[model samples]
Target: MIFTRFTLKWGKRHWALVTCLLLVCCLVMPQWASAHAYIVKASPGENEILVAAPERLTLEFNESLQTAFYDIKITGPDGNQADDGNVHVDADRPHILETGLQAGLGNGTYAVNWKAVSADGHPIQGAYVFHIGEPSGSPAGLSDLTSGSGSTGGPLKWIVSLTDWIQYLGLSVILGTLAFLLLRIAPTSMTREPMDVPGSYRLLWISYAAASFAALVSLPLNTLYESGVALNELSWRLIGSALKLTSFGQIWMLQILIVMLLAVTILSGYDRDRSIRARIWSSYGSLVLVLGWLFTHAMTGHPAAADQRALAIAMDFIHLIGAAFWIGALTAMAICLPPLADKLPSKVRGEVYWVAIRRFTAWGIGAVAALVATGIYSSLIILPAPVLTSLFTTAYGLVLIGKIVLLIVMLVFAWRHARLARAATGSRLSGSLKAELATGAVILALAAVLTHLSPGQPAAAGPYQETKTTDDGSAITLQVSPNVTGENQFEVDVKHADGSIVNDLEQITLSLTHLDMDMGIYEITIPKNDTGVYKAEDYISMPGRWNIKVHLLTKTLDALDAEFEIDTTKP
Candidate 1:
């Protein structure tokens, strides 16, 4: 008796704690975008060096690109006027942005800094470095390379993350709860005589309101991310820009409307005696509306701009609904099922719980099967065959692997509980289901991060810009462009105290190291350019701080060494 009472008390307290942890994990962890405003492809690609400078710059995004709200700045060997100072968008290809390069450019390292606006008003910005002729010690404007990550601050990111977490949570609740009603409850509900499930309705309302609130707040949060403006300082102009110009805004508005319709249909269905035929049609209408709402999500993600988009969008739609039914239903079980079993008349208690558990087990099985199938399809098209190896090699791929492992674990728990129910674990099944919910909670949290990460593919895509000086007052400010876990360009700018470029350095070499894992040193020569800079192209296969040792051979000093560190950001 003491153990039972203790277990019950702990369960009651810990349940809320667990739920809060789920949301906290979703918010605090490094956020991965859900492919809302993802890049489809770039002209030179990340860390790619061209033998000759391209005539112009072109960028293609997954969603419609808005130039009016964009800031495309390029600073290379010659300082900021590398481009013709105009970004052009073709009427035929609003999704593509292009700008002409300045005439008579020489061979040197060039860094492209761009901030493009998605139709949803979110600004997607990044910097890429390419070698033109030969390497200068460092490009003229190499110090000016802006990676765009700094453009949006921590406050904006956290606010955006919080709202996004709420959105995901809300989506799980709305879709999963409604699914439990239509699929698990409604058909059998006819036979159960419709007892007053006050807790169930209350749970439904909370989900509806949470989802509605998240969807509503999503607009302002989108504005905050795009404009780099604080939530309070977000003017009507910015909000209007996001809603009118971005794909996310348009889709979000439509969702609010559908959410209202969904609430009406669900709330009305509570009345069991009110014309069963009408109720069926209303449920069917609500289901159709829910599918429509899900399409908006499909349209706004990586699929919207990806190759074979129709296939990707269809797969993503099914994937989300399946996930909602599975995770969301688990949430409903955590919130509603225990109370439901209690409300059943004593004579029918055990039988009703058994019927519901069996029914939900089948539902869970279908949802899992759907998730697996769609997940495979998404991986294939998004990452492509050439980049498949990057999954195990890159940070993004490692995170994806972690998510897959957790999913497998969650699946095991689901399978175990189904067996326990079949063995008639009775009230013990309640404890078992709660355990399953905890595992599933983590799976949902990881899912939120997966979308933002590089698909580890064609669009496969970091931050390292620092300046260091030597003893003789000669500055060897070396900048490693695109400090991602893949390809990168290293440029070392050797200049005198008078600020004149040093083109006559006898020899220059570099060493890259990651001390933590004992990931040894990678050394290479950074030869001098016609323009007096030293540079070389190499791929770094990890995401962390890299210790750089720059060795310079000069007449005054036999061997002058300058050391500095560059921090690479994981994609």
Candidate 2:
């Protein structure tokens, strides 16, 4: 038997320095990430009063949308269907959704409720109202219209997170174990000898099966999530639609194919002759397949939606690989090392254990460095500047903080284990290794929840007011109370050149258009209030710069139009 000899001189001071660097990175890195798809503009805009009923309704999002499981419905004031039952995405513009409405609809408020799956596979839904001529009675409020949609805290969401956690765990183990075997174990073993760690191999097979099952099950769960359907409502048709029509489905299918190929490669190489060249090729093949599998996750995640998409995806992939090496290898060592050492001769046992631990420590340091650097870069790119200051308040930020805390704890355990490895004391190391693995599992759970959360913090609730002078020497002030997305009250006060209130207006119409995207104009009728103020409530839908044109019809039927630009923020 031939054993490889090497010297490793890492100590506590080095570990402390690394720990401080990680802490500094965490403190300085900006926080708060982005979110899934949202409505950027809508025709027959929320709470808008139209002179004539529209032939169709349209919605435009901030990002490209998936047609699979997309739904938009119009309900008339009488609670009957107002839409033509055919809703589809615009061919030329992937971000726009349009549906024909029943023609010649009577004067009343109509509801437009929409649900869609974003390109990144997250499901988002919203509801709004628009009136024809005049609003009769009150339509269902936004909250009431969205009441039936599943909340983010339900059993279904948790179940999906659980599946995600399991899949992550399984992948980590598979990749980490392979890395451990090829990079750490193989070089030390004789060329003719079979790497005979039955426990580790068994763990790998179990992980493979679990990961494969989780991946398969995730497809249907994703269908349920995207379609906004209950378990009982799930069908083959919906699943098939998701698979064929959605980016997530395509990526998932590719992942399954990779898994199949991975299975073949693993099985084919399992009992092959223990030649160095063959082992090297097999290891490289497995590593490449595993990386491809990991890439699918990055494609379906928040990074795919980022502005610097390619770089974001690459960073996310590197983060995943680093995590697999650190957490996965630790788990493998905890389970495989003790028993293997017990079976070896006393003198050789210490040497083997020392070699494994020393190699792992070296790799672990590199993995940790990669994780910290990529994590910081991803956070910076994913979150907007305004949101970074208030990171602790958002759910995503809190979860990420928890993950970081766990990572720091795991690092301490790793450092202790590395110190023990210097003495070649394999027996004393199992407890710390298990501790690190446990911490990693908790971190994975937090990560599962984090992935499902929107990193954008809700915009501050405050009225946005701006004053503009009309050509007729009148001062028109536009105030949007609670100028965040969703429901907001729009009030316009008109004053004559002498500062007297101008109250005798035939009608006040406000035309709103999103300046960031060409989503068409949204005309809203601002009715006169009891106090002589023209005010109405409507849904802003999204956050960005908006151009609002307020048209005033005097008692003599003369029209005056004034334009005002305002910025709305996320809700």
Candidate 3:
């Protein structure tokens, strides 16, 4: 009866303490619920590079962006179709959209044009120039790179890195502590060291309870963000559909694995030979954690095509594992330490926990090392600007820097606690250790906020321009030029014939409209410039989709209107 009452009283007090800690964790972390802007870098700075008729052209963004919104166009000096096929996203980096142009682009100015929407749902359009030193005899279709009118915007992408950070830190604290308790910390038993401590159940309950909550909440949040659905109405169907579309669906499988691991542990606790069963169950749990790494994060990372992909993957793996260890250990400490500290012999308790912590310290060191090295390498690949500038200017870079700083502080606190705990001075040392743990709590909160930042998209200037022109005859020609000073010239020539031209037509008046707007429409009087030819010439400012409406009115012909779409390139 006394033991039962003691357990109940202890549980009440400790649960209250942990509940407060959970609130503290939530309070310190800031939520980023909206989209962030990013700028992917361009070659030779937009319109500044001079290529010697290179075989290909490339454009890069600030973040590991998606290419669905990508658009590209290339036209020759004579306003003729020099592009062969439609533009396409690079198979290697979906974030990289590219297209091939016809060969033998003569030495005259050629336009290289492009437009795209960012992951944040913002539309970005621009143009650039690259000169082929001297025009070649290669046919236009040799490398068909053309643009058309019927283009739709890419699906909107959401930023989930902030939530990922929160998940990472929380998992670290919960898992790291469990591993320590199972593998290193011990309670005295009849013939062997007991992996289970008196209050360990409470610790596991709190850790797993919180973890389960995070998993559940993150699921809906992730779903809601991706589908643009309200959280309350996010149905299984929506989730299923989202999973089929995006890689995040794998989390559902991971959640199931965790549940299975939990079930095995619970079942083993009731077995006659609990010790053997417990070990088996714990090993299964560890396996689940490892698999969790594979199913969720490893699957969601940047395209694994770079030469340093292996290194980046390794770093991300270690970083995640280290996070799990840290957060897991903290959760264990919060749940177990307060209730059990007074029950065990001072010397024995100190030796056990200190040894466990010593083991953990090595793991922490490795995780930190991997996180730093691999993180830098990863940043170099994705973030806009040079490595140094990205670290400070970009949103992703700032968040990483914040995480690194907080981690350093946490390490310092750990070092101080290690020194104090190593002395084995009993209660006074425990007090200090608890204080250090408080700092760990703050560190976890910071990590949660860090997860929300989006990488890439650095601030940069746009070099895009647009122009419109209409022909008096039935045929309308629109020329798009990317005024890149140092690069090759690009031009787009559009032709429209609505059977509205007549031989006796003396004058042809044409008007231009760009995307239903006519603020700066340029007009062309046909048959005059061409000496009886019925086409007009005008310049398009940038590379992107355009709309042109031809107005046909001849001296003896009825008025006719026709609409057509054209994608111009930047030269």
Candidate 4:
């Protein structure tokens, strides 16, 4: 009950602190957006004969890509790398790579291996083989070979990384400063007078707040740049449109709330005559900040769209809030502990600092537990199949592992810090604890980077999708695309034995049954314009064998029912 009471009272500080922290998180989210699926276009567009050797090999794609992980490999007819070396990104083209090709690649089959990030951050990779007609060992030389050459729009990436770094740093500073202020300024007991923090410490908050605002603004710009939008064309109209869209709605509200809270807090600090109201505004501002944290990442697409969107949203909310609290508490400890220790006699300082550590350690454990439990649940709910192998094979999955590792490291440092705090050593162990906090800073930074990694879905280890077509002198043709989404479109045409077919079937009922149970059904009617032909669109929920029944209305008052067995599983 005392722990709960203390948390409830002190928790208000976590609100603003977490809000600012979440804002920083938004800047890092594009790293995980959309799994980066993209296709890089090859030069010559499939069918161009060049009389003279081209000086360069070029590639284009529908979307801008992550330069950090993009790769391109070219193989000559003999299946050796044309350059026999890895292709590197050229400063010239941000998204493209330029590499030298081997001097002689005699005509044969040439292959291109490429992996690119899709506009949404998904990693898509594939290889394409092309034939070279001429048979000369003379290696075709390339003066330059890089994609995204003319548009090495890499500034956006750096901006994002920098903003993210500063954001976390700002979080540490803001929360740290506030914690110091609380420990110093708040009354020790009901009868005690409030002790104001020195003007110098207050000044530091000014810089921290400014940095926080700059990061907020930089996030939107960085997002646009990452999406390949031209800076010059990034007008208010586009921003307005984004704000109106659901994807950016949460972020927009978060930013607006952050601005309002900061303004109120600043005004409260300056109103000189309203110290009581100022404290109230500061408290409210902090709460708004926590809410802001909840909103900033409200839009990061994950756990899939609408599959279990509500649950995913809830987990994301909790994750951000817990992160904010943990970060804020650390920041508070760093700023307030030393000064408070110096103010009180060494003995009392030891008791107070140790008590604070006890409180924070409990908090950290609870937050970490929530993070893990919800994170795993969210992962399981979104993925087609949840398996450990996905961690190695998928970007998102791999990133999750990396984050877990960092979390463990952070816990170790926290544990060490807790031990020292409890020991209350006469030796100057505060600096060592500060060093531990610094380690926590590194963990948060790595957390920021891992935020961008995609959590790839576990590839279905199920059997291949099998499609069958039995052409028994029937006019019907069925085309099926086997994806897990369960959508299938088919056309059936009936013909007379004389080869003259009725123009259209009045009514056609198509039903799929499995072992006498009706699995799915569709009803379609054909117009007179298309004689004896009927078309139907339907989906089967899962992969299995089923009997397809087709009821056709013939030209007369007669009707015919035909049945076909279909095996839905395919390779």
Q: State which candidate has the highest lDDT.
A: 2
The C-alpha stretches of model 2 lying farther than 4 A from their native spots are: 1-5, 9-33, 140-143, 146-153, 185-194, 272-280, 345-348, 423-426, 457-571
- Model 3 C-alpha RMSD vs. true structure (Å) is 16.8
How do all the candidates rank in terms of lDDT, highest first? Answer: 2, 1, 4, 3
lDDT assessment of candidate 4: 0.49
Ranking by TM-score: 2, 1, 3, 4
Q: Write the per-residue lDDT of candidate 2 for residues 1-571, one digit (tens) a residue.
A: 4456655676797678667757765655543234577666688775677999999999887778777878788888888889998899988998898899987799998878888776667777777788898787555544444411112325667778888889889989988888777776433452233345647668778998998999989998878877778889889998899899988789988988988998877765565565656655765787789888888887876886776677778878888899887888877776776676676677667666666777888777778877887888776765555445535655566677788889899888877777776766543356666778889989888878867776653335468898888887898888998886676899988888899998888899988887755546777787754355888987675556689998988888877778988766555
In model 1, state the lDDT of residue 308. Answer: 55
Q: Over all chains combined, what TM-score does candidate 2 have?
A: 0.77
Error in Å for residue 133 of model 2: 1.6
The C-alpha lDDT values of all candidates are: 0.63, 0.75, 0.47, 0.49
Candidate 1 lDDT trough over 10 residues, lowest sum: 1-10
Cα-lDDT of candidate 2: 0.75
TM-score attained by model 1: 0.66
Task: Please state the error at residue 12 of candidate 2 in Å.
Answer: 17
lDDT of 3 at 300: 46
Instruction: For residues 219-330, write the lDDT of model 1, one tens digit per residue.
Output: 8776777666555787888888777867777788899889989887876666576776666566666667767776777776456655556766787887778777777777
Top-TM-score structure, candidate number? 2
Q: Which ranges of candidate 4 are over 4 A from the true structure? A: 1-155, 168-211, 230-246, 266-272, 275-281, 301-306, 346-349, 378-386, 427-429, 457-571
